[model samples]
Target: MMTKWERLAHELRLKEYTHLIVGPGASFAYLTGMTAHVSERLTLFGMNADGHAALLLPKLEASGVPRSLQIHVYTYSDELGPVEALKAFASDLGVHQDSRVGIESGHMRIFEEHALRQVGITHLVSADEVPMALRLIKDSHEVALLQSAAQIVDAALTSTLPLLKVGMTELEVAAELEYQMRKLGSEGTPFGTIVGSGPRGALPHGGPTTKQIEQGELVVLDYGALIAGYAADTTRTIAFGEPSIEARKVYDVVLLAQETAVDGVVAGITAEDVDELARTVITEAGYGDYFTHRTGHGLGLDVHEYPSIMKGNPLVLTPGMVFTIEPGIYLPERFGVRIEDDIVITEDSAQVLTQFTKDLLIVGD
Candidate 1:
């Protein structure tokens, strides 16, 4: 566990990055299992190609860093500032202007970049891929966290769906759903809970609104639960009552696409091929144009990760890889439908981690 950064350091050396600096975010927590508090203070996890690493943090946050990031801990007081500590960090690590430093482009802020520059390290590069490549594969611990997150989300969505009422506002539904998740033991939400109702469902990422849900309209409930820094994304579209024939037909198409895509997931298959499995179904059903967005995305420490399940991405699926298989279709100004499930690639096949039933449900009547 403490040696995780050793792998990243080796990758950096292969890429000729003499040192790698990570900031406080999912990437940081991925390595440390500790979330660094970031405000105006400068805190960083630095690793050199020699596999030596240290943490430079505010004195207040120093105690919280784990041993993984504590091989050499340097602290700066609020009054003294981080400059002096940073100087010593660079000097001890033998980092200089010529050292090829890399930073987490995904999470490192501009101010953090300037701080690194102030330390005389000139060859700073964006090496986000170096660590993400390691994170792409799920270890036993990460898989357990993801599975637990899915279980909590499943329970929350299952319990909350029956509470949706026709006249209930989308915000009301979202609130109930989120509250259930918390009561069921989720740490927090990975992203904003989406409760798009009726025509609002046409907006893929549209959030909950004050608009009231209506009878005979489709409601898109896209949500997830976060646990131990891992998250699961699941979306289910339900009809308040009997939906229009057109809406029903569209929903069926999306369901077919989503299920087929998930079933096709297997080790050695390309990510784009899995995407094609779903896209082809929708396209042949004459609803391809309405199906926007990629088939799905990788899910883990962050809501989105590597091995994008989209057209043109040739990333090969492997055992222990987890991602979402969500195919959606939005008929503008009408109702939309999306069915999503979290999937894990097995040795020869795949398993759907999210146990939420994808069947079209008639509810909120």
Candidate 2:
């Protein structure tokens, strides 16, 4: 099997790209296999088809690079500018005056691009599809990391629910869950923990707030953990007490939608088809308009990656592809219910990575 960098070099050669630039993000981590804190600083790694690569970092960050990779390391001090360092690294990589460099358009900074332009490299194009395709399929090792991360969050959620109280704020619950995730061995969280309760649950991405949890309301806990650079995302909606008839009905519909979608995960299925399956369930439940957002999204190095599970997407599912199956129903001013699970496609069917029981939980009884 070709190494990730070697495969990237092959892509560069095939695309006739003279160089490939990656900045800090999942794309950077995917290519380099080394995690670097993302900042405004001009740290970067440049690669070419000739198997030549160069690393330019702030002097203090130079030591973080692995000693095994034989790439040229160019360090810049606070006194010396990053522009000169970029020039030196560009020369080391043999990026010519007219080199057609490829960059991750989403993550590359304008200053970084200007540095390349100043260093005599001319043409630059987006190589966004390269990493998107390369990282879409998870290898066994990647799967294991995702599975371990999912297990940690599942265990944490299982242990944290019993601690919920009626008067606690949404932020408090989020903090406690994060604490449990960390205690269960997660290196970090994939994103800001969301603990939307009561009417706020209608907001799809409503982050945790200081609003107190009240009785007879639904709380949506949307969060995930990151381990070994891979991520696991899941959402579970629970009631603080006996919710209204409408709330319980919506919860049942969302749960059914989530389960149906998860069951439809198999190799060769179109992403849109999986999405429609869930959407159909919600529509038949008389909450079609309430089912906002895509049914799910791919989860990996970053929380949201390629292969979005939504209507009109043509991407076909395949073994090793993993994503979330979160179907939600949000009735404004009433409540919202979203049940999510991480799903991995197999040779014949799908493997649900998240082990949390999706059955509705009634807390603070």
Candidate 3:
């Protein structure tokens, strides 16, 4: 079992920091097994070079700290201003003028950084890059949790498919999908559900609208489910009736492109190379300009994280790293098609996490 102290030690080495300061993200959760309800009151996990760790939080939230943390906990009453209390707490923890602190730049507020400075701590550095690099390679426990999340998303999409039909508004279908995901034990949708019918499908991030699904129109459903802080992203394009020849051609290109991209993912391959494989396929099909957005992005605690699959991202792929492979082709004011699946890289090959059928499904009178 990985103890909090052990996790902290790993982070210290990964970040090459004398001390670590964490906020309310996976880094904090992974190390302490506690969720910080970040707000006006600052919550932090601080660890020194010698592996000694401590937590500082608002007095009211102290009870929520897990017993497994096995670290010194300091809290400040609401009566005392949080900043003042934090300063005193830092003093007690021996954080002084010469302390080198690592802070999460992505989640740490500007004022909080200023406060740390006022308290006599100098040499603060961004710790996000280090943790992000570490998180790219998932441990066995994280992979198991991610697989479970993918299954939940797969079931939710399957159950919601039967509700699709001509005349149903895109917003209605989106609502039904959300309801199914919740009923299937997903904590919530990883992001806003996207339901695009016909021309709206061309917009990758198109939010659900009141436009009704028409016969022969291609509908794009892009969504994911959040389970225990992990996320799964998938997309499927289905038609209410027989698709036009043009739609089918575009869909086929996207499917082929996505397959090529997934095949490119392997241990030691650069993330950019994986994206190029898909882009090359789409370009050869004469739809390169139509296919926008990166091939994929790393997924875990946040829907989007490090090691993005885009041109120029030189991060090398490694076993246990998970991300999405989505290739899309859109025609303005006409229609679009996309096929996406989550993939986790292995020593020899990539494992597809999302198992929902990508085959074009036609449903209508």
Instruction: Score each candidate by Cα lDDT.
Output: 0.88, 0.88, 0.83
TM-score of structure candidate 2: 0.97
- By how many angstroms RMSD does model 1 differ from the true structure? 1.5
Tell me how far the alpha carbon of residue 268 in candidate 2 is from the true structure, in angstroms, after superposition. Answer: 1.0
Task: For residues 239-269, write the lDDT of model 3, one tens digit per residue.
Answer: 9999899899888899889888887778899
lDDT of 2 by residue, 1-365 (tens): 98888888888888888888787788888877778777768878889888788888899987788777777888888887788888888888888867888898987888777877787777889988777878999999999999999999899998898999898999999999999999999998999998989999998899999999999889999999989989999999998988888788788889888888888788999999999999999999899999889998999998998789999899999999999989998878867889999999989899999989988889987
**Per-candidate RMSD vs. true structure?**
1.5, 1.3, 2.2
Range of the 10 consecutive residues with the lowest summed lDDT in candidate 2: 31-40
Clashes of each: 0, 0, 0
lDDT of 3: 0.83
List clashing residue pairs in candidate 2. none
TM-score for candidate 1, residues paired by index:
0.96
Which tens-of-lDDT digit does each residue in 261-288 have in candidate 1?
9878889999999999999999999999
Error of 3 at 27 (Å): 1.8
Which candidate has the top score in lDDT?
2
